[model samples]
Target: MDHLIEFWPILKRLIKYAIPWKKKIILAFCLLISGATSEVLGPILISYFINNILSKHKFYFQSTLIIIAIFIILQILAVFFNYFQSIYFNKIAVRVINKLRNDVMNSAIKQPIYQFDSQPIGQIISKVTNDTEVIKELYDTVAPTLFRSITLIIIILFAMFTLEWHMAIIAIFIIPLVIVIMSIYQYYSTPLLRNVRYYLANINNKFNETINGMNVIQQFRQQNRFKKSIQNSSQLHYLARMRILKLDGFLLRPLLSLISALVLCSFIFSFSYFKNEVFEVGILYAFITYLGRLNEPLISITIQQSILQQAIVAGERIFSLIDSKKQEYGRNKKRFKTGKINIKNLSFSYSENQKNILNNINIDIPSKSFVAFVGHTGSGKSTLANLLMGYYPIKHGEIYLDDKPINSISHCVLRKNILIVQQDPIILADTFFSNIALGRKISEDEIWKILKIVNLFSLVKSMPKGLYSILGEEGNTLSVGQKQLLSIARILVKNPKILILDEATANIDSGTEKLIQKTLSFIKKNTTLIVIAHRLSTIVDADLIIVLDKGNIVEFGKHEKLLKIKGCYSKMYNFQLSKY
Candidate 1:
């Protein structure tokens, strides 16, 4: 009862996914009933043959052949119905699980960016993939088997009562015993199944982290440590599975078989004790056959308890993800016309318990100017960029674009106008053209023109398929400079009003930096180009440079003016100059 109370709501939610295919589910169940009825009738026909025809010395060859033919036809019809019902159930399960996986994926994507910071990628993937697959087993295997077994048990019970009322009363007592067994199984197995799922998810997380960091692991010769970690996770999963197996071996089929043997002995003794000259052989045969059939379903029901528990656990995880708070966007449809940005009294912390990442930042960035922000590590450079992109909610700040509050801007307008190019650009495994256009309907001519401007036209032309060549996973075929150029090309096609280059030239060669500089000269004429500088040489020509220290703006001036002041920026620039 406690398990049912916990699982009822999840079952109710699962029904909604199945409701869309109600017609097919209903037809399949009807076929299942028909199949079970046919199975019940077959034993009765055999009993009639044994008592009325074979024993009485009245067997006509044609009559006996007719009865035999009818028996075969009944069995064949039962098989036919059962097969089609299973097919329908499998089809519905596929469609329902597909919809569920889509919902899980959509929910994961819609969660706030900060949520991803707290959650592992592998755990999220496990929810969408592994958990959904287990739920699929509920629909396809556990659900259908339980329904069919119950149907068959009910039909067999009715047939038993028709044979002998006293025996039927005895047979019905097995149901309560089976129920008790199932209840016990549920109590022991639910927690074990939940543990199995947790360890499995942990294994997936370890594998994902290892695969993504294989280079570092091998470089530092830490493969043995990672291997041991994954093995420990797998060992935990195996122990849980073995515990469930031992519980099942002790509680499920063996207990039912014991009851079956005792019941069989009671039925045989009842027949011997109640015997009379008029006792019919057909009735005795039918009762025993019905008894055997009854045990089959009882055994099946008990065996499926493990699968049902697993489904319940998987459903809980999937629903938890689906119920996570999604990032909400405003309804304002206004787009930025001029890229002027204003920040006033801005302060932010990643969490309430942590120190502020940005402390009372105030700045006025004019339209169509080249501005640079330079700071030491942990000096709130990336945090400010994240806030400007609206990746995190602003708790105590006012950011405005064109005199409108940043939060008032609709998601569509903000995404379309304010774009950032990170240090390591994301390159997909697709043709160069799709990577640049990114679902936009940019002309091939315009794309080629931009490639030439970025000095990548020669690289593309040299490829086997030119712009149509596949970039492979993460654009592994391309150099770092080439990938960065591709990121810029993506920005060029969008022509965003406010473009941020977040350390874009921090990892590239000198030649690529020069090309990027020339490209920035073109971009700054009509867009707000904000550069977060790592190498001071790139930002030396900026119209304005801001230096930050420990989340506070320390100085703001032209590069030469800052050098004369000999403050933080001057020391940092001179240090980098000394390195080269």
Candidate 2:
């Protein structure tokens, strides 16, 4: 019952995406009808050849040859129309799949930071890649096949009844019996197929995780353990596939038996009735031919039911992902030119029962001022940064930029003005210049200037292919410090007003850190810079340092002032000095 209910939404969405290609679908259906009619003519033509030309010794070679030629032409035309139909249908299916994939990706990316933190990367990838492919198969294979089967059954049965009433009655009875048997098999086996799909997804998820964490596995010398995990997942997938195969065998045996029985009985009954009649032997041959034709369409429907059921399951999963809530655009707020940020009584928690990650955190950052957040591990420093960027919602209170609630501002405006340079830079496997440009159309001069500002001009000039050098996967060939420099250059090219550095210098060497520090000092006067750092030495020269402990501010003042107080900030400073 639940599965049936789930299917409705998928059906609705399929129709929604398919609306644009309705004309093509209609043409495809027309082509299917023509093909079906051509098939129906084959048996009738055989009956004419057997009864009129061969049996009564009254033969017209010209007319017989013409009929044969016309039938052949119709068959050729049918194949041509089917080919065109497949082309249009596949094109539409690809478009719908692409649209669905894009929508799901956009929604997942826009989800709250907490959602991203809690979800596994592999599960999300499974939804976007494997699940979407299953939906595509539904359109490419199941939908058209099922529709064509219906057309063939209808046209064949109509022709059967016109040729002989008694045999037609037997067919009506036997066909319904086959349908009943198929329906029973479908009802009992759908749940198993659904399980097969889930297991397949689980296997894919496990494979993706193992491949992504291959480096960690090797570093920890846990290759045996990782291999065992993959082996277990593969065995489970094999068992699930075998279960489906078992059900298929069970259904096929009984279906074949039923079809064989029906054919034998029809042949015996037809021979008894026409044994002594003046009818041409060719007519009886054609009748037998038509009987064989009728059985094939019914067999096709029986066999394809399993595929249709699997498709329904796949469609349900895909539609569930598509129907998920989209991230709110927040377009109603008024725009402001100033860069003031106000957090008022803000509280946020990832879950309802958990303690707030940020509790009543109220602060104001004036326009064009450099502010830094200093905290220990698990002190909610990153949470605060995410909130300021509107990556997640605050459960209580609100955040404002220039006195306008941040929630009301459009995402486009926020993203255009605010940018974050993460600790681990995201390097696409692409050319050096393309990675730095990152989809923005910037002039060559602008690119060179940003590269120079980040002190990467010397490196680029020394390379054999300057800006065109290809970076290996995730920029693996680039040194850590070099990747950091490239990240800075990428950000500088964007020219954002609000710049965020979340421990951006943590992975680089001390010399690279000093260079980045000098660059930050140079850019601080122009941009609203918010730096989240654990190393007290990094933010010592900042205009203001806000110290956080357990989601609350323990101290907020100039670095020198906070040190003089000998509080949390002083203790952290003293610890760092001791380490040095």
Candidate 3:
């Protein structure tokens, strides 16, 4: 009730996630009603047994037996209703949460490439795992318990007024006092619990950062600093909990019990002053029984209020992710017949305030021609390659694939035709065969043939499990060069019409470079090959060498032709030659 108006929209958004389980929710509500009816009748049946048997001093055997049987029947009915309620609610809770988790993950996976570059992996993962788990209480326990508690309170209040209005007046009058206590408790505790959730996410993000960068942390001896950061985050989370603990220790349970005592003492005072026959001790007993029952739900509602606070915070985070922009794919599904790529006055930068990484560039790469983009570091060679792969939207200039705008081509068609092999391989923690084929229907024979083309067949064939051996999470078993070769084998299996090797061999040794160079020579025969390289010697045989400096291409021609001009390319070539 603290922010009920603002909370309603979030509640409504969360409810939509449960729409598919509406029938189950309705059935669970029916069971809850039945259970609450049984709960209310408990006080009534006990009242009747005490009033009739004790007050009249005449116990009819049949009447006493009937009351006993009704008591047993109420209890048995309660057990059945509770059983079905738990069954239906729990089942639907898990299903709804599973769907929500899936939607969050799918949204994360399909975000724009730049999102992964800018957003922390830990932050994204915390929203999916930690925040979603907190929101889960909306279904798992809080929703059903909140429903049953409110229904039982209503039933109990109804019975109290009907049986003895005088005592009921005293009991009901204290509810506003209890509501005030709750509102006060909520006022302080909401922000505390919210801080708790926030710090929990901070811990998640920090811990994730710590584990992922453990190598860097150790290499630079920054472990102590990272430890301090994690400890600070954990301490903040602990402080938030201590505040909630202070509130819970003194405010809620004790205050509600005090009100409960007041309700009971007021009943005793009325009994002492009023006429003896006018007040049946049985009614007083039943009223006390209902008062005791009232105590738990009141405290529970307070607890549920705190849970609602957490859920609101978690829901906002979750829906924010679901509402974030997803990667766009064009509607057209046209396929490129050849590998011809054209660029006209291409220029781009990551942000508006930043300088362009590629500037006023123009080039034409014919089908199946070998083109190398050679530049010093920060000259935008790799950025241009990423743009050509349709990794970013064409903002500053036009890129055409067979005379059609790149955005007009379908992602499926584009991905099927173009591939990029990065400098570092991304090996899954699975078998080599699975890594290469990755759930495709390529045959074992065809896979072996492709591996042979990359000169890895004999190496794989001599292993213990051959292609079936599981790779480590980082592919620690394979050398850098071997990993690059395996990545190329993946491209060969797909056999894209175009391949861009973005510094794919920059990290390998010279001995391994010859092997990769041989593989590239074989690949250049069939596809339009583009190489973004730091090493000068690797691209000397390139049909066209494009040299860039400060986002502008300063030279473009055959390697020997550029060398003859004694420009930036020749200087870089001479620098590398002196180093070797």
Candidate 4:
């Protein structure tokens, strides 16, 4: 019951997608009716043959053969119509699944960054893959089965009534009883199926996590631990499956028993009451055959109840994700051009109750000036950079670009003029030129110029295919320094107004660092540069230096001025000087 309630929203959404296929669905219905009518008439024709030809010894051989031929032709036509109906329904299922998957993926990509941080990657993957598959099964298998079962039941009832009204009434009575049993079964079985689906999702999530982190497990020599965890998850999944199967077994046996009992009572009553009438043995046989046909559709509907419930549970989960709050995008907002930045009373914290990660940070960067942020680990340097980049919302203050509040500007506008290169570079497995260009189309001359600026021109020239050379899997073939240089070269081609290098030189040797630093300095003439570094020597010639401690600006001045003060920056500078 709970699972059905949960899935109700998803079913409603699915029904919206079905609207486009109403014509095909109508055609399918017409085919189903035609097929059922032909099926019902088959037994009646056999009965006619037995009574008229064998029993009564009728000798109209030519007409009898024609009637038999017509019946065979009708059966063949019914098979063709059934096939068409199946094909049409399958098409509708595919259309619905495609639309649903697209909507879910779009919603996921638009979700706030914090949401991605909070949720497990494996669980998200399960939703996209496994949960969507359940929805597809609902449309492809359960929906058609349900519709066909209903059509069969209706046709069977109508045919039985035409043959013997009293017997039809008795059969109808059993239907109400069957309905009550189904209701009870659904009420009990829904929760069990819901548990089964939940456990199954967990199992999938665990499997994905294990596979993605296989390298980590091997590195730590924790294969046994992972194996044990997988075993435990598998056992839980098995138990959940068993619970559902047990419930199904209990419901199925009782339903089948009741159906059998109904058939027996109907037969006994027919034999007792109609024995005196000149009823043909063929008619009796046909009625029994119809009774046999009736049980199958009923059983099919009963079995589909479990699958329908599972789909509903899946739908609920999918819809919940789709309806989650997405990252805010400003509408009808004015766009801004790149210029100087101002941070005022900017006290920021990741969580509301947690300690502030940035405290009363007041700073100003003149247009095209190179500013450096220097601090020890856990000093909130990266957090400050994230704030400046608009990756995190300002908590207790405002950031202004060109003396206008950054919050007033749209993300698209901000991203257009700002770029950041991080410590760990993002390298896709693609041709060297494609990786450099990302998705943008740039001139070959521009690509070469950027590569030359980063001193990667010789390396590209040495490759057999030059810029067309393929980088396998996250550019695994390239050294760390080379990857970093490639990333810098990629960004240099874009030529943004504001450039941020967040620990960009941390992984490279001093020689490579010097080359990158020289290139960055050359570019700083026109672009405003913000360098976050632990190596004070790299930023010794910066226009200004800001020393951060526990999210607060403990000291802020030029290197010479801060050094003369002998504050936090002075101690760090002197320590580094002694080490060198």
Model 4 per-residue lDDT tens digits across residues 101-129: 88889999988767776787666677788
* Residue 520 miss distance in model 4 (angstroms): 1.6
How much is 261 displaced in model 2, in angstroms? 2.0
Ten residues in sequence with the least summed lDDT for candidate 4: 329-338
Q: At residue 428, what lDDT does model 4 achieve?
A: 90
Q: Could you tell which candidate, 2 or 3, scores higher by lDDT?
A: 3
Residue 301, model 4: lDDT of: 80
- The TM-score between candidate 4 and the true structure equals 0.92
Provide the overall lDDT of each model, using Cα atoms, as 2-decimal numbers: 0.90, 0.77, 0.87, 0.80
Error of 2 at 149 (Å): 2.0
lDDT of 2 at 162: 73
Candidate 1 has its poorest 10 consecutive residues by lDDT at: 275-284
Give lDDT: candidate 2, residue 411: 84
- Displacement of the residue 226 alpha carbon in candidate 1, Å: 0.7
Score every model by TM-score: 0.97, 0.92, 0.94, 0.92
- In angstroms, the error of model 3 at 51 is 1.4
For model 1, name the residue pairs that clash.
Answer: none
Best-performing candidate as measured by TM-score: 1
Candidate whose lDDT is highest? 1
| Regions more than 4 Å wrong, model 1 | 277-279
In angstroms, the error of model 4 at 525 is 2.5
User: Comparing 1 and 3 by TM-score, which wins?
Assistant: 1
